[model samples]
Target chain A: MAWTNILTDLLKVNYPIIQAPMLGVSTPEMAAAVSNEGGLGSLPVGGLSPDATKQLIRTTKSLTNKPFAVNLFAHNIPSYSEDDLEPMRKLLLQLAAKRGYDLNAADLSNFKLYNYLDQIDILIEEKIPVVSFTFGCLDPDSIEALKRNACTLIGTATCVEEALYLQQQDIDIIAVQGIEAGGHRGTFIEDMPLPQIGLFSLLPQIKKAVRIPCVAAGGINSARTMKAAVELGADGVQIGTAFIGTEESQAIPSYKTRLNNAKDTDTALTKAFSGRWARGIRNEMMNEIEQAGIPIPPYPLQNSLTAQFRKLAQQNNDIEYTTLWAGQSAVRTTLTQSKDIIRNLIEGYEAL
Target chain B: MAWTNILTDLLKVNYPIIQAPMLGVSTPEMAAAVSNEGGLGSLPVGGLSPDATKQLIRTTKSLTNKPFAVNLFAHNIPSYSEDDLEPMRKLLLQLAAKRGYDLNAADLSNFKLYNYLDQIDILIEEKIPVVSFTFGCLDPDSIEALKRNACTLIGTATCVEEALYLQQQDIDIIAVQGIEAGGHRGTFIEDMPLPQIGLFSLLPQIKKAVRIPCVAAGGINSARTMKAAVELGADGVQIGTAFIGTEESQAIPSYKTRLNNAKDTDTALTKAFSGRWARGIRNEMMNEIEQAGIPIPPYPLQNSLTAQFRKLAQQNNDIEYTTLWAGQSAVRTTLTQSKDIIRNLIEGYEAL
Candidate 1:
């Protein structure tokens, strides 16, 4: 039972841990460092163009020969109208003005996000060893094509129903993301009630219901949490927030600092930042936006609107306006090299 | 590494499982059945008279010399005014009329709940082997007196903050009650953000922060769940739903059937039931009461008022009027003798 589960054996990693494919935060260097340290590293190709996806895949391959995963967002594109986008835009403009930026409402219009079909083409063509999808599952045709290419597929499930549905589609692994996880929720339904179960409670329920390996994700930033995940029947553990401050992680300095300064009780779930529920550390902007009761548009529209505001705020050290994505355990992580973090995880597992 | 943890050693039980002290559901016979089968069973003394609490303790002891636990509520009794009572009385009267009873608003006027100080006297005098409390921690005097009596004190905590607070009070065990738990939430601060972390997430956080044994509770009703609890750093498990159908359990026939017919998605948290949020199956009363958006009074008043209504409804075999407390895993539990359920748990843990 010493790291002899299907996940480790299939991924060819020494420890049953995965560097969670964090969209804006993970870099090729970071993924390489984790893979070099005997844990599976991941690069997110979720929202990139096919060419960009291929270029990053090549960059990562050159950096490390060890196994790594490529992640994609397979969510159905949400439709919205002008009426839906007004309040969120109004709030965003006001926040930008307070930050001393002459931001306009039109800059956020024409939100665009296509599904991962083209990205899948690049991954299959490049013979990518592992592929993970969040937000929703792939259709039967895509599932067949990936299987033919010898890709080990991973799907994200926030509830038992989603896990079982993913299992029915015959995926390789299920990343059981609890409600406390950072960034976007991997929920499939647009209006489904948030399955507010925590990581530990959710992991076992999914593990018991499905036969596939479960990669427990969400607030897993420490050795104790990792150990608890393993003991609770996780074949592997996926970590995100803990790697925010590493040399290779792509988060801004202030974002890293905010995460570093956080405490156990600091994080909360808000659709305010991206119009999709995700956990993050609370700040002035979040408080103002949430308190205003501004109805946000769907994912890509509200996300696109806030994207520019977040970037400009980060550039000026104006954390009050940034969407600081972080898990509940964001405060407990140490600032270090990604390799050292992986080494510590192995040490912690052995110590347990 | 085995069942050699503080909770098992202190309780002198063979298995690391404790049938939850469910008021109105657990009987002296149920407690004896569990203790006799080598797990600690608990009797809840919440709002009970000192004499009645003593009588149940004696009855439990008569059935089995094996170790058992006595539980009490440690909540601060809220002060209410006539303004608060008027709205709740209106709702109760309307509900009673629908159940074919001529209920008056004054029936719920005299809301009363005696504190745990008197119950502690009986527990100490009788030398109850184990004692647990919920809603809040015991004060200095009660803790000191309980320690003097050498009682193994267990405190319920829904969040790490509460667990740390309980740790400072020098409790013997921390029952990590997750948000998915049935009945009342044992939160101390009414305004504190509900630490919605599941048992797995909360257990490790508590285990990492404290030195005492942690007993995982909530939605743990099956062998798989019990095993999962043990693997995730739980020294013991406090189960409620699974034991509801046991021969020794005191639940009514229709209530037991409702539990049997429940699904994983059947439960919802409603303050309408007891004025404190607790998860249970949605029914005719729950649907009607919830839809009305009735502003409930504080704990003892609303709880006391509902008690009479539930009693009358049960006598008439009316399922719509009774309060049925059940966890998320209610559907998975089956009707059986309590001893057999205990045996299954032991077998499940060993198999793991």
Candidate 2:
């Protein structure tokens, strides 16, 4: 039952387990620790600047020589004028005022949105071995550029149609994200509504439809779920929430505590925080914003608009105001080192 | 690999497979066919009257002597006056008019809403050996009465809290209904929103929490999913959508055709048809009712109002307006016999 497959060979990892690149929580130390433990660790640069991304990649390289993935947000950058973000700005201001937080107009202004194309040269220059992306597929030019550098591309998909699209783009691996997945949904199909296909249904369908190695992501925190994903035809598993509790993660103490205390039914999907559908522990911020029934601005704009407020809440350790992204099986998370988490997953899978 | 567990032994089946009692689709022949194939067949008596339930039980008995469970809707009966249902009636009428189907006042009136209590005596009189319930848990009196008659009780839960409640009520087996399940959600806990936990995250959590045997229900169609559920700690599996494709099922031709043609992402959850959350294929009726933004009446009331419209659509083989309830894995379904489905599942598990 020793795990070795196309995913392992392509990613150059001993085990097929992948530490999902969780923005805001994942760090260079966390990624390096997981990779050193024989699992594919991911560095999320979806929200970082090219310079910062280079620094993080250099730091991770300093920590481990093992192959690790660098993840980016491949969404189309929307052209938004200041006026377009006015209503959402007012809403967030109103919400922050209720929480006794002061926000000035300057706090939400001058937000720089990162484009996927801008990050390609940085990955190529850094010689990043594996590149993963979510939100949408990379353009043909970006794909060719990354392929020319010999980077293994992993595209995120929430449905079979998206998986097929990723394969059509000549992507090397497909990360099949189920509805139970935490953080932002990787749904890129514009004409259709957000796909909420569970892993039980999505994994097998994607595996049957696509030829590339499919990695199951979502609510996969334990050996049982990992084994179940493999039984359903997944070549590997991409775990996210479980690693948030690891010592190497950069999550706030309260966020880690909430993950430890969460029940299976404690989480819900809300676009209130980032203007993109994400699974997280239901709190006052999610409830109040959703209850207000106002149209949320799209991602990057809304994500930037609420940045100051989220920072203030994080500083105060106010769990209610800050985002607490988690999967349905986040109840399995425990406070430990990244190495122990990876070792336990391997040992547990072996025992099973 | 021969499936013999607490669930199989208690239900008197050779394989730990329970054909889910899909209300409109399950018939006496369908139930008996599954039971005869060494799987526990279920006769859904939730919507039928006491006399009709007795007759169905007798018919199933005539078809097979193998043990089969009788399913009931244990939700509390809502008190609704004619005036209370008037708004919903008018809304349905307006929607029906748009479809060129005249829903007259007489057609929507005089509907009888059956109570779970009324159906208990029929099971006792018929000497039914196994009983199951969904929507909510049965009252203590009903539980005691069924227990007095030596009936093994199976309760449905969509979350950990509901499963613990069923276990506390002394339920013999718990059907852990995941978000990918079709038909009405079995979530009974009030004061919270509907639980949409996927099977991958839900099964293992319920297995850890409950002392009683747990049966995984939702998105379990083929041998792979069945084996995955067992590996994830399910004592058995309760499949619903797969059986709709069976020849013995009472589902219409168009419904069966849709099931065969559906993809994994085809289904969605909508509360417009029944006032309670249920997953089904996206159709005109669901989209229109949801888009209209009118408040839906509670179950039985909304269910009654939509009955005439659903009937007309079914009669004309118009899949658009019909209630095509299905699971997320409906794409895995094939038009076959109940015996072949059960045999395939058993053989598939063995091969795995």
Candidate 3:
């Protein structure tokens, strides 16, 4: 009678809803409240050190005894050649001089990735109940280690073929992502057309082809749509954009306000921020980047090159440069307490 | 714990999801099936005779014992001067002769529109349980007559001010339709912006200001999204494009095929057909219409003038000239059976 699935039972939530692991947007309080309200809440590992990731998990655990998830970006961090950083630095200086800022150089020491392997080790040692992945799959060693610790593993798949591949690896669940999903595309396989499937069309096809339980992700954010996904054979749903306006999220106040004012037609996927396709509000940065016509470097290097610009822009409330990742349902986000948001989600289910 | 509201209890349904009343696409069989599944089903009264309207209601009643709705066009039907029809007639004659179908002059009489008020008499005589109006509101006499018959009167509103006006007119429910809705724009009092407010931003504001229960319409198709609507404050939802894909629909095979194959960006609202804005798949007719640069006549007359072209195109399986009205959520509709679709919607509610 409660949500009929292993996920709902395992998570002890009323329904098989999962708040998305949105880095720079999700917070420990939000995650904990969602978990407490009987839906799996997730903390993102992107842009975090191992210590920070563990601290977030511990803080979330302190807030609620319910099961929660930790999401990891399993892809290898790209190494930036000095050749790449020098030009990016020169461009920044030139732009800054025009803006009347003193061009004082900062120390360029102690820069390194979070050491994903070390983070995985800590998660496994701590016996985290659920570990979901995006960007790429875990190595065989890591997958086996997580399994050995009796952890539920989920892999994000943008296509049916990818879902089948994940099933072959004996993963517990598959998050069937659609083209409308926010953040970096999880397409690591061959270059597909990004065919733009919706939840109603994609869920059944994945359900028919795969043996594992399917979790519909991407643009789902409503009671009616969640019910529709379940009817289409999705065992659970992962929602991200619906929670952007929650009081507990780490999203900037300006970003949250903009999200509240967005329209369904306001969202678009651009490869401007982070050198990968992500859906967000179209802004000046996207227009400028597309006009520049420069070949964007791959992954972490492109991310690192613009890190300072992003920090300065976000601090200045300049929305253009910051990576404002949100899905098509972003405008549906309501300004409310995280607990109240979960309560309304439950009521939406009940109304349906 | 059933989905039984005061209105649903009065109407004898378990849920509040209403199949939006659509002209040309809606048929008797479709209306009955939705009513049988415990939701409101509406038939549009445009371009139908009094006898035809009564016959449609009788046929729907025979198919199911539950209540159903009938929608009426409240806008002025345009009258064509002899100058307008003469030029159009000559063009039609040229085309017919080219196609080797020499129609007698008498055949032209069949293209004229039946009066809207005459159709209303058939609806009142039938004592229909629900009545809806689009494009404008009816006079006080019409509202009084329907209310005396114990009909639930609903009005379509494009903005918050329009909704307030409908409330003042003593409407039972106000349909808060967004810009993405298919078919003609429902602006009654004033000409609104093209592609004005989207569903997510529009729903909350209307719900906040309007005292009457708001029924959310325009581009809703899934449980998760519907949940968001209800959570934001809609008491019910009315969907058009989703139900258009069902087996009971009167849509051509090619129309359904195109809808299933549509991308997120495939739809556009063009005034090439019906002289009113409607969303559909882009086709050669729309392109040619745009290029022709002829001043479009008013409604009903413009719709009447193009009748021959539409008929011929359909007979030839031509996608052009067909008023394939569908919302932005048309991409999500794939159900072939109404029963299965109703069940899926139920499950979507359960998951929420």
Candidate 4:
């Protein structure tokens, strides 16, 4: 019944629970708070520049001596000319204009896509103890570099085949994401539709196939869910939506409020926001895009196009227009501090 | 942790496991074998005639003296003219012709849809102890008639709202079907897409809201999954896919072979086979319908149209053309006797 296991020993945390590195919401303060409270706090640098990643890691280190993780986006950046993005750009502009937001062509342009390779040296130099990546696995060179630093590498998988592939590539651990997860899907397999296996079904199969520790991600917010994941043979639980409403999270107030008020059925998967499937609370923007039946451009292209529009919506505190990323268990989220959240998890599990 | 909870006590079973009433695959021999092994066996009469239902119940009774459940489909049959069925009928004919199966117009007609209301009296008169239903709830008159006989009533729910509704109607137990469940979805709420909440997310939410005993269904095949469900507060479990490969199951040899060979990602939700959404192994027929982007006629209509084609394909043992209903945990299934499957489940849970 004790939480101590291979994952806890490897990450050097008291509990096997991990705060998910949510790109738009996770903050240095949040990661430090979790790590300081004996859980693995993750710093999401998936969308950040190397300088920003360095600054964030330094700030987190200043706040806590406990171990933490740095997360990166390892997906291949799609090649596209400016002309290829014109149609979606015009559509986004028109949509923004209808909402009384002034978004120009320049607002959607000039966005640079960062490769995970560019940020590897920062992790190695900073002596980051843990590194996790989603959307795909890290390259061999980067893996070798991280391995040289003795970093505990975690790769995210949405199915058994992906978990096997990650283990074969020498990942130290695998974070198996379920369909109930929020944000982007970690499916990297090509020529197939997205694998939407839930945590209950995906965990045991992945555990049976892989030798490395497997952490269950998605829909794990409470101690009951955590224990359930453990019962299904998970080494640990990677929690996201539970921490998104915490005081230290950088998620906008409107997003937090939506998370607080949402129900189990309120969240759904949509590719309209970034052209990659992600689970979030359904809103006007998602509904409009789906109703219009327009084909969304692939990942970074669509992500870049919607950048300014999301920013403006966030600034205006518009819940309907901004991306309100949350998992299916958003109803379990509470707006509390990070330390209290981790404490409640541990205490709840112990009481059970 | 004892399996003797409110559910088992109410249903007069030794264990908290219920064999799912899969419409096409469940058989009296299978149900009785499970009942004889101290599990709650279920005879699925959802698509059977009143005479057939009575015969199945009598056969099962002759095989075992233990308690079992009879399942019914309670949805309103759509009122469609013969003209409404012509186009879909013609399409099925063309598809069957391509597969070298001879079919005439008369072969497709004369398939009668049975109303659950017509089957309630049979249960009352036969003194059946347990009745479960899916697709929708039974009418008030039918409920009163069954309750008058002191029969235990179980209703299927795909979301918390549906679970709450079932509780309000005084259902003795709720078979909370997750998106990972096979066969037809039990979503009855109007103006919404099918609620695809997985067991990991849906179980805790439904358990928190309803006062009745909740039996977790969908993607639960092994002892680990069974324990996971119990940890998440399910009073019992209703298993389906685990029994598809049983020697007593009425599933075709090709279907059982496919189930034995399937992985976690092989099953997907498709509304193409029937008007209503159901999970099954992806086949050429599903791909063809999806690729053609044709609007399938609603249930019973579409069910009738494709009935002959599925039958012909099964007769020829062609896996590609038959409906292979399975849950996400199909990989865990094995070809064995129903009694052995129950014994393995009990032993597995005890070992854990």
Reference-based TM-score of each model: 0.92, 0.98, 0.61, 0.98
Point out the higher-scoring one by DockQ: 1 or 4: 4
Candidate 1 structure, TM-score to reference: 0.92
lDDT of 3 by residue, A1-352 (tens): 1476776765556668888888878898988888888888887887578888889888888998888888988677777666655544555455545544443335122346564576888798777888888777888888888899988888888766677888888788899876557777776664644434444345556777788888888656667566556656778888887787788887777888888876544667776667666778877666666566566666665565566666777777767667777775565444477777667767888876
Kindly list the per-residue Cα lDDT of model 2 for residues B25-139, writing each as its tens digit: 9999999999999999999988678889989999999999999999998887788778987877787888888888867988888988888889888888888889999989889
What tier of docking accuracy does candidate 4 attain?
Answer: high
Clashes of each: 0, 0, 18, 0
Model 3 Cα lDDT, one tens digit per residue, B1-352: 2477655755556788888888877888888888888888888876677888888888988998888888888777665676765654555455556555544455544565775577766677888888888877877878888888888888998767788888998888888886557677777765434434555445666776777778888756767556656755778888888777788887887877777876443566677777776777677666666556566566666677667667766676556557677665565455787656667877987876
Worst 10 residues of 3 chain B by lDDT: B192-201
Off by over 4 Å in 1: A12-15, A190-192, A219-231, B12-14, B99-102, B219-232, B316-321, B330-335
**Ranking of all candidate structures by their DockQ, best first:** 2, 4, 1, 3
Candidate 1 residues B1-352, lDDT tens each?
2666677898998878899999888999999999998888898888898989999999999999999999898877788787877776777788789778866665677755788976888988999989899888889899989898888899998777888899899988899887668777788755656666656556667777888889898868666676556656778889888888778877788888888887555677776767777777777777776777767777776787777888887887677787778776665455588888888867766786
Worst 10 residues of 4 chain A by lDDT: A327-336
Candidate 3 B-chain TM-score: 0.91
How is the predicted docking of candidate 2 categorized under the CAPRI scheme? high
- Give the Å shift of residue B192 in candidate 1: 2.4
lDDT of 1 at A327: 74
Q: What DockQ, on C-alphas, does every prediction get? A: 0.35, 0.87, 0.05, 0.85
| Chain A alone, TM-score per model | 0.94, 0.97, 0.91, 0.97
Better model by lDDT: candidate 3 vs candidate 4: 4
- Determine the iRMS, in angstroms, of model 2: 0.8
